[model samples]
Target chain A: MSGNFIVGQYIPGTSPLHKLDPRTKLIMVFAYTIGLFFLPTWLPVLLAGIPLGIAVYASRLPWRYLLLGLRPLWILLVITFLLHLLGGSSTAPPAPEDVWATLGPWTITGTGAATGFTTVLRLAWLFSAASLLTLTTSPMMVTHGLERLLGPLKRWRFPAHELAMMTSIALRFIPTLQEEMDKIIKAQAARGSSWRYGSWTRRAQALVALMVPLLLSALRRADDLAVAMEARGYQGGEGRTAHHPLQMTRIDRWLLIITALAGITIILWRWA
Target chain B: MNGMLTLRDVHFAYADGTPALQGVSLDIPRGGKTAIVGANGAGKSTLFLTLNGTLRPSQGEIKLDGRLMTYGRRDLEQWRRQVGLVFQDPDVQLFSASVEQDISFGPLNMGLTEDEVRRRVEEALIATGTEPLRNRPVHALSYGQKKRVSIAGVYAMQPDVMVLDEPLAWLDPAGQQEILALLAQLHRAGTTLVMAVHQMDVVADWADMVIVLQAGQVIYQGAPQGVLAQQERLLSVGLTPPWPVQVFHDLRLAGLPLEGEPPLTRAALTEQIVRAWPKK
Candidate 1:
């Protein structure tokens, strides 16, 4: 159950990608995502996976775990792929040789297969790139990078520091809250509250019971955390120095330049 | 008496008008271990809050090193910097994902330079013996490790006095000893240590001064030796005398000959009994 929630799961390492500035990775992933939309054909989509593949390799993340993390998303990816496979474009008819298979009123064509395969590949690349960012960078570093990126917006009255702090805190408590919930569930189960074998309405009722305690505990925790924060001299994030301050190193700079060049090249190719 | 922190006639009430602290006055000795013991409804936690400037006393005042504490924004920040508070539950205090980052929060909020914050974080991690867990996520840690990281968070601020609310609560015996050792280390380094604890044995073994609270008022405040000798007074306040004290009292009541005051700690009791044993 816990393995599926992989977005914020960080694996500690000293690989070059792990050592890169989080801001660099953030920007690279952002540009890569936008470039992914510009790639028109299956060939360009496959081409786009090259940099992502290199990133995954550089991250030194265990391939088994990385692949396992994508298990939950396979359902969505398969659904999208199947939709495109069965629902071919209405405007153009494929060459007779392009006909692949026919099932009850639905015809599978080469173009449909290409579109489905390309769409799945694009989505996989997007997921992998995003996952790689989190896998290498700690949540604190990500928050630090985000705060630095949003520093300029402070002039416009943006509460960037507070937002980052909140993000970091939320990330910290995710597992704690989860553990609390697990305990509550086991406690409830011991009290003869069947969570697994309930009717739809019964399940809803049981969930309400579970949710009330979770929400109440969360609120209590929030109150205690606020007190703790205040006792530690937290005052609105003003004048606070970051322990892991974000600074772009030479490698970070090179990575940024390479990502920008790749993005522009993809845009030019799509335009041409 | 003058000490690191002096609270005079401090009274505090919740927003709902329930009094948590009522006319509480005490002094926490400088560079000394002061333990506050009380029942569940007693205001030990409330008093710690007032000490750290988290809750302003409704009526009376608190002084730190001969200076009256102020509630102004800047003053409160400075006050909190000088007096760090570690809550009983590490989950509440550990707000950062990583141990190092959590420890860094206090020093960072002090507006120190990045290098200085890093130094302080490293020092705190080493002090609490949580250096290896610095990069680990807070939730991944065991309860005892989380407890140490929480202490490390407050220690990074390098407060003149550290106040802990039930620092040993819910810990195993070995973990409690480890924390007590950590506290002793901090004290040896010149930081005043004040804690509200329930373990009577810990209070007797560790605290130089013991303050017993009943219904938000101080029932007794003095040396642990003097306080632990009065078993009835402690029991009335919902606190039992330390085990050795109880045994010492029982021995005297059973018509056994024992000299001097009752031993406040196990080692003292054992030594006294050994000395009183019949000759071979």
Candidate 2:
């Protein structure tokens, strides 16, 4: 039952992508995602692959591992592709110049396949790009990076530090909660709760059984954690200092420049 | 009067109106291995929370280092740093997935520089013999190892006094010895330890002083030998005298002349019997 819990997706390494400032990687992933949407055609989407490959290389994680994580998305990828293919653009009529083919009652057109291919590319790349961020960066680094990026909002009275602290605490407690959940499940199972074999309604009842205790225990743990954090001198977001301060490096700037150039190149080529 | 912690009629009650600590007063000595012993319903956990203001006492007061305590933000932040607690369950005490990160949590909260926190983390890892596991994830650890890492997290704070709730619970005999030895090492280094323990023999063997509680109040406050000697007195409050004391008492009842201060520990009892062989 605990097999599904992933405590940390971070695979620790000193790879360039891993060493890049999380803020830089975050913006790169964002810019890359936006570029993915704006690329005009399949050719431009293919051009976008250059930067995606570069990201995969820089991350230094196993290419197979990165791609393997996308395996579960194949179903979504196929569904979107089929939807685009079958449901093409609503139009008054297909122009004679538009390539078309008839398959019995269904008319398959060039625009259908093209649009389907492009949408599949974008969705798949979106997942891969996001995976790169989560795989290479530790959750704590992501929190700190986001907080530092949000630092400017401090002028507007935003509690960036508190939000960041909450994120870090949430990441820390993920596994603790997993362990507690595992305990509750096993306890229930020991008390003769049938979790594996049941009708859907019975299973829903079993789920409710599991959820009640899990929720109660999770609340108790949260209370304990709040008290523990307070006891550890967590004095809110005001004047609290960081031990591991985040500092950006030249490599981060260079990575951002490269990502920006890639986005521009894809746009120019697609428009041309 | 001035000990590491001085509680004066400290009282705590739940929001639903059930008392958890009832006018409990205690003076935990400055730098020794003091044990708090009580049955399941005793106020051991409640008293522990009061020491660091985790759950503020409902009434009365506590003093640390000869000064009265307050639960104000700044006061509590300072007070908590001075008294670190290793909770009974390691799963609850350990927050971070990374062993090193969790150990660094307390010291980092102290507003220490990264270098200083790093140093203290190293010191704590070595103290708890968890240096090899510094990079391991918390969820991957065995129960005994997790307990050690939990202790390491608190130890890294370098508190003036450490309070551990049921530190020996769920540990094998060897694991128990390791923790006791670790506590002894800390005591020798001038860090006082106040532990809530259940085993009467452990109280007799390891503690410089023992505090016994019953139903949210202090029943006995004295040396383990002095308290355990009065078996009938202990029984009324839901405790039995340790085996060594019972053995000595039965021998005396059986017409043996072995008198002066019955042994408090098993080792002491064994030594006495070995010496008294070939009875005159």
Q: Judged by DockQ, which candidate is best?
A: 1
Taking candidate 1, what TM-score does its chain B reach relative to the real chain B? 0.96
lDDT of each: 0.87, 0.83
| Cα lDDT tens digits for candidate 2, B1-280 | 3487898998899899889899999898888778898888788887887888888887898999888998887788788889988888887777775899889988877778778889999999999999999988787898899889988998898889999999999999999999888888888889989999887788888888989889999877877778887878877887777889889889778866675788888888887777665583
With a 3 Å backbone cut-off (N, CA, C), the pairs that clash in candidate 2 are: none
Native-to-model Cα distance after best TM-score fit, residue B242 in candidate 2, in Å: 2.2
**lDDT string, candidate 1, B143-176, tens digits:** 9999999999999999999999999989998999
Off by over 4 Å in 1: A1-8, A91-102, A269-272, B257-261, B266-280
Candidate RMSDs in Å, in order, are 2.8, 2.5
Question: Residue by residue across A58-137, what tens digits does model 2's lDDT show?
Answer: 87777886667778889998988877676665564556566477667556677878889998888878888888898899
Model 2 spans with C-alpha error above 4 angstroms: A1-8, A96-99, A102-106, A262-272, B250-258, B271-280
| Per-prediction fnat | 0.98, 0.52
DockQ of each: 0.75, 0.53
